[model samples]
Target: MNIHIIWDEANLPIIKSNLSNVIDVIDDTIAVSFDTWLFSSNGEFVIEFYHDGQTIIGLK
Candidate 1:
């Protein structure tokens, strides 16, 4: 299953939990939650997105 692709809305919370816990500002919604933060362990910055029970994480 592609995380970027939107699916059932019921999975939103689960997806968000998997990608949760970061120093990022997020505007959460039923369809999608968007956030961005830097990984303190390695200074590896990331942009995290959760939508409809799917998760997409990107590094920068």
Candidate 2:
């Protein structure tokens, strides 16, 4: 699945370097072909969640 990440352009490079193993980075956000997962570091285990048809999944 193709994944498009949303982040500040300034942080793009750093985020890309870390997530390269899992996703394909693109310059803009558009309709992606596959499921999208967002990962964010929160001073603990990184959180991962998928976007369902309505809202974000895996919220705790």
Candidate 3:
């Protein structure tokens, strides 16, 4: 499994402290959108987000 995180740099401490429960941190933030991407053996996956948003995630 792969885990991805996109959040404000200022929250590094909080995020680091909760690595085991990172999803909770993202859930607590006020973000524009949250999404996921899945790829097949021959396919490519990508994650896109607006920089102005509070948090972004591309869980694959």
Residue 54, candidate 3: how far off, in angstroms? 13
Per-model TM values vs. the true structure:
0.23, 0.27, 0.24
> Which residue runs of candidate 3 sit more than 4 Å off their true CA positions?
13-46, 51-60
Can you write out model 1's per-residue Cα lDDT over 1-60, one digit (the tens) per residue? 112222234554333222243223234333242332222234344343443345455555
Candidate 2 lDDT over residue span 1-60, tens digit each: 222344333434333234454535431221342333344443222323333433353433
- Measured by TM-score, the strongest candidate is 2
- Enumerate residue pairs that collide in model 1: 11-53
Q: State in Å the error of residue 44, model 3.
A: 6.3
Q: Name the regions of candidate 1 deviating beyond 4 angstroms.
A: 1-43, 47-49
Assess each prediction's global lDDT (C-alpha) against the native.
0.34, 0.36, 0.36
Clashes of each: 1, 0, 0
Better of 1 and 3 by TM-score: 3
Model 1 CA lDDT for position 47: 40
Candidate 2 global CA lDDT score:
0.36
